[model samples]
Target: MEIARPQTDARPSPVRGPTPGAVLALLKPITWFPPMWAYVCGAVAAGAPIGERWYLVALGILLAGPLICGTSQAVNDWFDRHVDAINEPDRVIPSGRMPGSWGLYIAIAMSGISAAVALLLGPWVFTAALFGLAFAWAYSAPPFRFKQNGWVGNGLVGFSYETLPWLTAAVAVLGHPPSWTMAGIALLYGLGAHGILTLNDFKSIRGDREMGIRSLPARYGAGMAALIACAVIALAQAGVIVMLHMAGLDGHAILIEALVAAQLLLMVWFLRDPVSRAVLYSAAGVGLYVTGMMVAAFGLRGLAMPV
Candidate 1:
């Protein structure tokens, strides 16, 4: 009797080993820092006009924005195991430190806690939290796989990351949803996030291409992708200046615009290369500029309109 030989299959060995700090890194806890500042600015913008409680708004930022974002990141890492295996083998699950299911449970639990906080704020905040959770889920899940949906994916993640936090802060203080000024801040931040996401795609171009992912860098070459990143940052900066001027927040605008221009120039130079270090620096720089601008705007506005 002739037996068919077992088919020969060749693939890289599955990555193994537990990283003790896997869960910490898996959450990308650092990413939530900038969003917290963004929400604080939103709170300032909301309460500045009529003078409202800012501390509660800040608390909302901590509980709703960063907490939820961290949880969502864990969920993202869990669902993205295959992609991570190819794009970032040393990551938490791919590296074998934490189990994928555990990550999912952690994300779910955190999301629940965050939603409870949102409910304490009000109905609008609760609605925003729900939307954010949905976006986070779809970002890496199979049905409506935003990560593979190109620009659509980027927009989903970007909007949730930047917009919802600001809206939540505004709602926490203003007792309602986003106002025109709040919307402007969201738009500006969202654009910057879009650039960051696109730039990140450049680092994973090869893996994305091999995995049939439709990321910006895979669809467009790295050079063009970086150029797009620069353009997005420019537009985001321009939006901030325009919004500040339109809102008649002139005193705040001057300082914010100057800082933004400096940051923009840095981004332009950084985007000229797809080097890993450049990308990392660019991400950090964006975070710094946003935080600094928020501080300058809120600080000056508060002083200028002293009660």
Candidate 2:
């Protein structure tokens, strides 16, 4: 809801239509990389020649990052505007760059545009987009607002960002459901991403507690939240490693193990000072994590290598 402010002078207010930059800021493009990367991984893991349906790959990436993911960011920023006023007053909405309910309007418009694009992709991608948009709204809007709880919110976002894009891309390129191996790997990576998203909560722990948002750090204290994050991430990564080995991708499995070993060292530091080191781990640890995702994808391609 837009709040009314009292006039103190006859001068005009800066409130007006949002500029293109403000709209972009509201959409938060920096947050789009994860889903885009996941989409590529999915396409790769499908073992189809990328050059054959390169257009589908391009469209899927666009849908994952700019269209679908961008709408989700807009929705989240709109709903979190009040909270941002407390923790990040300079964000577009709170900063008055996006004035007078423009954020909500932009979100709605983007959702419609995203739908049209997804429809062009095909039935599999379209269905995933519907569920993706639904969860995007449900994660932020009233009566649901899954973002209020760390467990539910993290799981929703993790799956929506990682698994949804990954699986959708696989089907978009392959024109059918992916194999169980591909699906299971996507699930494992998505679960690990839950821990990654949880790390984002540490920055606003105080505001989250003050505003009744039940982020893991605010709900269970930062130290415990860090431990839980590490455990979830490590366990998910371990699952991928075991599955890779079982699939006879021993070389890839060893590489992922080395990556996880590196992340474990960073996790130790993150646990020591979670509030301060969460971002550090997110950058360093998550780099290795996503690296494993691509490695796993490439390894799956080996399954179809020449006999």
Candidate 3:
């Protein structure tokens, strides 16, 4: 049975011609970067050391993340035109730099290409790519509007970004996910994603409040949101440490865990401010922690073998 996808007419009409810059904005660069990096790190952490076939893994994930993230952002811009006009009038669609319908078409095209790349990776990757598309569409769509439901939306997006990609990387290199270790990693990764998303909501709280979007930060206010972000990061860091110990990872792993924990502590300190500088700091911490952990895992693996 053929599943009928929605036709192009079902998409919104854009107000104007597409500008090169508008198309660039649809890429959603910030959202794309971490997922790709995480996938690379995940392949390393899953016992496939970086620098060999890692490029293929990185290429697959690089294609997948941009397609997924970009498609989601374009769809979001389409649905958010009204709100954008009020809060972000300079945005592509609202500013008349691009049509919403065209953006949707672009999204569909990007996702199609993403799925194609996933297919090249074989069945497991294809399956994950399908899920990524489904979640991206359902997130901001009518009835599902996952983001409107506070933590539910946060969890959904976070899990999709964090755990799903981890699974993809694991499957790509190992032909399956690592048994016994996945659950703890999934939990900690999900928490990290949730915390990051909440920080995003904190930044957009004013606009969200005015637009009547019930984001976690909008509902709880900035201080409480900051507290929640701190708690989530702390818990996730601890969980990673516990999981490493349980997995019998050596002192090198413990060292990496401690560094990540300290990084989180620094991140928590800035959650209260959430200024542009703070957001950059948060991103740097995440990148550093992920990179550090991957390097440490590979380092330990090296030491365990014959010299």
* Candidate that would win on TM-score: 2
lDDT of 2 by residue, 142-225 (tens): 999999999999999999999999999989888899889889989999999999999999999989999899999999999999
**Tens-digit per-residue lDDT, 39-79, candidate 3:** 66556556654566666686667755777777778777777
Off by over 4 Å in 2: 1-15, 304-307
TM-score of each model, paired residue for residue: 0.82, 0.94, 0.83
Model 2 Cα displacement at 16 (Å)?
1.4
Best by lDDT: 2
- The candidate, 1 or 3, that scores higher on lDDT is 1
Clash list (residue pairs), candidate 1: 18-97, 19-97
- Give the Cα-based TM-score of candidate 1 against the true structure: 0.82
* Cα RMSD for candidates in order: 7.0, 5.4, 9.1
lDDT of 2: 0.93
Residue pairs with colliding backbones in model 3 are: 14-99, 14-100
- lDDT winner, 2 or 3: 2
The C-alpha lDDT values of all candidates are 0.71, 0.93, 0.70
Better of 1 and 2 by TM-score: 2
Identify the runs in model 1 with alpha carbons over 4 angstroms from their true place: 1-20, 48-55, 292-307
